[model samples]
Target: MENISFQTAEVGDALQGSNPAHLYPDIFNQGSIHTYDAAMDQAKQMVLKFLNSQKKPFSGITPNKLAEQFKKIDFDNPLKEYEALFKEVDELYVQHATAFHLPQYIAHLNCPIVIPALAAEVLVSAINSSQDTYDQSAGGTLMERQLINWTAKQIGFSEEADGVFTGGGSQSNLMGLLLARDHFALHKYGHNIKYDGNPLVAHRFRVFVSDKAHFSNQKNASLLGLGEQGVIKVATDERFRMSVDALKDAIQAELELGNIPIAIVATAGTTDFGNIDPIENIAEIAERFGLWLHIDAAYGCGLLLTDKHKHLLNGLERAHSVTIDYHKSFFQPISSSAFIVRHKSLLEIIKHHADYLNPEEQDYEEYPAQINKSITQSTRRFDALKLWFTLRLMGRHKLGGYMDAIIETSKQTAGLIDSDPDFELLGDSDISILVFRYAPTHFSHDTLCDLNQYIKKQLFHAGEVLVASTKVNGKFYLKFTIFNPLTTMNDIRFMLNAIKTYGAGYLQ
Candidate 1:
């Protein structure tokens, strides 16, 4: 690699700097306090502009057009002027960025962030604390631990429960499976899967999950070296919840085949349908079969705080491990998630005695390192701060109210879809997500599918609204993942009207 050094003195002098100054007033080049202040001011102005600017959920720019616009910028050269660079960024990225705050954006799990969480982002970014170890993030670690304990209590976990902030639900699920894998290995064959690699009994190890569960289970199995086939897809009920009877049958079949059932992953909120599995029933099955129960509650974990819908997570407390994504349902930003374990000692599976990072001697200390419990990422972000700031500033009920509002909106959306002759509602939503497809009278299944797909593409290209598409029993369906509390019934009506309008055009 070739490196080029710029003469800071000459550059600063040329930029009209008599006192100590930075050659370039950027975040990375914090040579002077004034430079940092100036950069922050510029950032504030840019954020204000981006927020205030009234743009659609999307920009309606095609990939080729975006590519052409981006091609104008030369990465090798530097735009030293902060204003000019921000302007370029605004034009190239911000203008085209998906607006999750928009009520019309009913695409995925992305939610409009709360203001307090956004404020916390400023502090989190400035401090850049790594929550891997105590030495690196003392206050950050404590804050994370406090938040973890708070969440555990909310989920009705015992005092033996503990957790670590993770990147997101996927990593959390991975950690849950990793812990289950190790524990199963040790219990079954007295082997350590982590150090000894895959145990001799690993071939027979099987994990059961709902057919509608997040795809992360298969990915986690593959990442853990148990090929994707290690995951057994249990059948779901009519409402798309994991069927306990089907799970029992699957377990019996696995046992009949001489396979070792390791874990049963019950979902609190499935990705597409937003259906919650029967956790209590599944927990009973897990206990009877001696299987590790893991609940992937990434989307519906917010119900823990909801006054009305908290009962939806009836048996979440019984899970050995749980994945919670604050970003998805708690209205926090990305990367705010955690993997909680009921028994804190089970987390010791990921522990490593790195003399430089987290020495084994620190185990005797009152507060052990956070990295010891985390299964992924040695250098982790202080994501817990986002949730802490949210709780402190907004309080618990207000946050729960936001979830209540969205859930109500989802019900209203489902009603609209059900009443409309042009659409067909798929199933009941346990959370704030509705899956339905545009269906016109006397239309063939193939034609309806094509029309629905076309409507989605046209709306996406026109930047009017953004919704998601999925398949249910070989048929296409449009999904509305309503997480924005600001979304009203009128917004739902408008989205449906647009879908109908586009569907008519496609049929014509």
Candidate 2:
């Protein structure tokens, strides 16, 4: 071999130089310790600056204008400098991003992420653990399992309970329904739908959900090869909760029609009203009919940690499976959610025996792999770390306090809307979400609906505030989802005033 300088190295030398032991001092090179530290420090400062500069919930930029600005960017060539790239990101992206931390951004289920969860995100990305198997993630798998057990205990499940982290409440709901479908098949007809395709009688399989339940139930039924018709929309009470009497009637009608009832999905926190169904009464109905009960507690799972409102989820323990979204009320980042089952053995329905991943018979006994239970994704992110870190640093009580504060804020907001002559409170809130409309004395139903819709559009375009809109009984309503613990009465008053101002202008 010929002696070659680094600048004019041969193929062999270049290959060796590409190794981790020999690399350039840049952020892209893992071997460069100095680059990593400097890059992280710069990123931290940029985040802090952005946070400090965001005084409003949004940038007020119109969609067309933002799209035109983004189209000007050239991706054909690299900027070659972190500073230049970061500057572009700040000006074009971060500046226009919605600020969920702001008190005025009460649009959806989004929450301000906790500091500990942010810290855990840094570590999680650095390690890049795919928590699907034990070999790929030794401690990560165990940590996730332990967290699932803890959550199960919090929900009053027995020691036989088990669960796995999912992408979100939607996926969790899918998994819950999937298990229900398979278990019903096995129990009723001694058939394994997972191995065999959809049974011939699958069309007769019915799943009951409240009319106000999340739309995922119908979607899940469709995805499970049970057509949309498989989902029977049971009537809801005045509070937007599933009516146990209506449920009994629906089940009886299904039985009369020679239909098989697979499961009954009870909503712990409905999307628009935040109303919780009568779980105790629903559980009784499920047991009497021998139907699987699945509770979608995505928004109300925070009550599990609250001392005062935990009773709201009184019959949650009787559920066959449950879906909980920590990101909604637990203050964790997006995608921190889990689908838990009352019986660990029920998870075997989705288990697979891949030799390379989780062998059916291991050489030695150890913790089971997560892939054995997860039905949605194979390459999963370590989302459990976010909740784990949050619990470790903030404790359950502090997290519950955040939930309590937001719930109280909803109550106060309802009171304010009722007291204000310009606004009409639609119904009471069971959680942090309240649905009401802008109703003036002179406006008709159609005019009030249009006014409320116009107000939401104006505020969104102006970017001063962000609220959601929904319709109840063919009338438009402005929704206030108060999940920010920092949101005070003053903030609520300001939001209300802005809505009034916009409504008045639209009318004029």
Candidate 3:
């Protein structure tokens, strides 16, 4: 046989020679790590400036304009391009960024991320590991698994639970619902539905959620092909929490109509009112009906950190699955969320086989074959690294303290609202959110709501603050969502005073 060149040599050369530390000795130290440290410091300064001055709400960049701009960019001379882009960005657009860290930013559920978590983000991104497979993300996968165990324990689930990081609360809810849908259907009908599609496991599958549940629950139901109408929105009580009696009645009604109750979604903390559904009561109902229980505790997942609020999610252990958002509750950056299942094997619903990605078979001794599980598996980012860093730097107790502080501050703000005769505190504060209206006189309920909505719009146009509006008892009212720890009672008071001051003319 003639001596022939093989591709293995080329692969080996590509792997070893492509290492920047070896190829670019001038920009890097021969062996000392300080050179890389200095480079990282420079990159950090440049990145921080970019972040501080980035545009808010994405600068309203149109797709066509963005496409044209992308085409004009060149990477051959990357450093020049980088400098020019940074200059343009810092000069033209930095002031428009949403001032999330500012004390007055009390409009939405967003809050400034913890400084430690923010720092970890840059370091984690620089490493860029994919978390889907073990080899690709050996330490990263282990970190995620450990974090999942901690969260599962926090929720009072058994040691057999498993979870995966998702894009956000929305994707977390989808994964939770997807597992619930598939698992319940398979247990009742058979596993064939996994491949064929939604067969007649029952005439129709129904999901029960309170009126105060986040819209994502219904949205997920629709996206899962369960139909938007499949979500049964049960009535809430005066405090906006799901009424157990109403839920029982709704479930019985579904049974009477010959519909299958697939899942009962109990929310730990609602988005609008911060109302927590009666988990213990709902758990009993779910157990009796043999329905899958899912808790959408995305916004309130931080409650797990506090002993006081932890009991609020008393029956979470009974849940088949749970959706929690670390971004909202843990003060991590955006896109930190998870879908947790009590039984680890239930994740198989998301598993699918592909010959190209994971060949059918491999030698068990030499190579371990990959199991295709997870809702999304291809080209995934290592989001879990930052989360692991967050948990390590700030233990569960400290994280819980942060949550307690927010809830306590909310209570104090409600007290301030109550002391003022001009303000009507919507309901007694139990969670971190308070929805109220500035009503000084004998205006009808409907009229008071209209006045509050008017004030909300006026505040937005003025660009001073952004408060939300929602209806209660068919009457409109302005809502103050206090997710930012930087927000104080004084800020809430100022916002109220502003509303009443600017809306004084509308009062008459």
- Highest lDDT, which number? 2
- Clashes by residue pair, model 3: 53-94, 449-476
| Per-residue error (Å), model 2, residue 73 | 3.0
Can you write out model 3's per-residue Cα lDDT over 355-454, one digit (the tens) per residue? 6655547342243222354675475777777777777888788878778878888989888888888888888646678888888876665577677777
TM-score, cand. 1: 0.94
Query: On residues 1-508, what C-alpha lDDT tens digit does candidate 1 reach at each position?
Result: 8997789887777666554334454444456567678878998887787778846799888999899887777888989787898889888898889988989898989999998998899888888889887878889989998899999999999888999988899999999999899998988788987778998778789999999999999999999988898999999999999998999999999999998899999999999989899999999999999999999999989999887999999999999999999998898999799999998998887788788887777753576588888766888888889899999989899999998998888888888789888888887798978888888897787687788889999999989899999998898788888989999999889899999888878857
**Colliding residue pairs in candidate 1:** none
Off by more than 4 A, model 1: 1-31
Task: Rate residue 342 of model 3 by lDDT.
Answer: 93
- How high is each candidate's TM-score? 0.94, 0.95, 0.84
Q: After superposition, how far is residue 357 of candidate 3 from its true place, in Å?
A: 3.4
**Candidate 2 local lDDT, 1-508, one digit each (tens):** 9996665457556666666444456634446776788778889988898799999999899878878878778889779877988898888889999999999999998999899999998878878889888877888998999999999999999999999999899999999899889999988889999899788999999999999999998898999999999999999988889988899999999999999998999999999989899999999999998999999999999999889888999999999999999998898988799999999999988987878778878742475689988886888889899999999988999998988898898898888889888778878988988888888887776688788989999999889899998988788888998989999999999999999899889867
Off by over 4 Å in 3: 1-80, 91-93, 201-203, 359-371, 442-447, 505-508
